[model samples]
Target: MQEFIPHRKCVGCMSIKPKKELLRIVRTDKGIFIDSKQKMPGRGAYICKDLECLKLAMKKKGLEKSLKVNISKDFYEKLEEFLKKLAVKSFDAEVWE
Candidate 1:
């Protein structure tokens, strides 16, 4: 028997990938934040771990659409900083899993 792996679609690349392989950005009543634990309770949008994906998502306002809220520039800056810290360049399955 094999374990079931949940898959989610990236709003930027519009590609289906394993849930664990993508970064989850959630918007709650409190505000929007990166749900690294994926336990944040609210509307969530998934994106690839690549900076390009993040940029595309921002440009297309995909996160705003998914969360049905206006995303601030500060939030994007913070997210960019976080992604930089992670040094995410490409989709490395081994690193994520």
Candidate 2:
């Protein structure tokens, strides 16, 4: 038997990629969250880890359309900052490795 790898489409770039390669964002009764664990129970959307993709999604309103909710401006700014930190951490990890 072969192992199965799930795939998801990035709302930003609109490219299909393996689920593990994308970042999962979910919206629940509480609020929106960056689901690093990918186990949050709610309406979830995926996007590439790249900042450019994030911008594209915002520009195209892809995330909003897919999640079926209006995202606030502050939320987008916060998300962008989060992604920047993530990028820095990942880059450091790669360098150390």
- TM per candidate comes to 0.86, 0.88
Mark the regions of model 2 whose C-alpha exceeds 4 Å error after superposition: 90-97
How many residue pairs clash in all the candidates, one count each?
A: 0, 0
In candidate 1, position 38 carries an lDDT of 82
Question: Could you say which candidate leads in TM-score?
Answer: 2
Candidate 2, residues 1-97, lDDT tens digits: the string is: 9999999999999999999899888989988878877888999999998899999999999889989999888878877876787777554322220
Which residue pairs clash within candidate 1?
none
Error of 1 at 49 (Å): 1.1
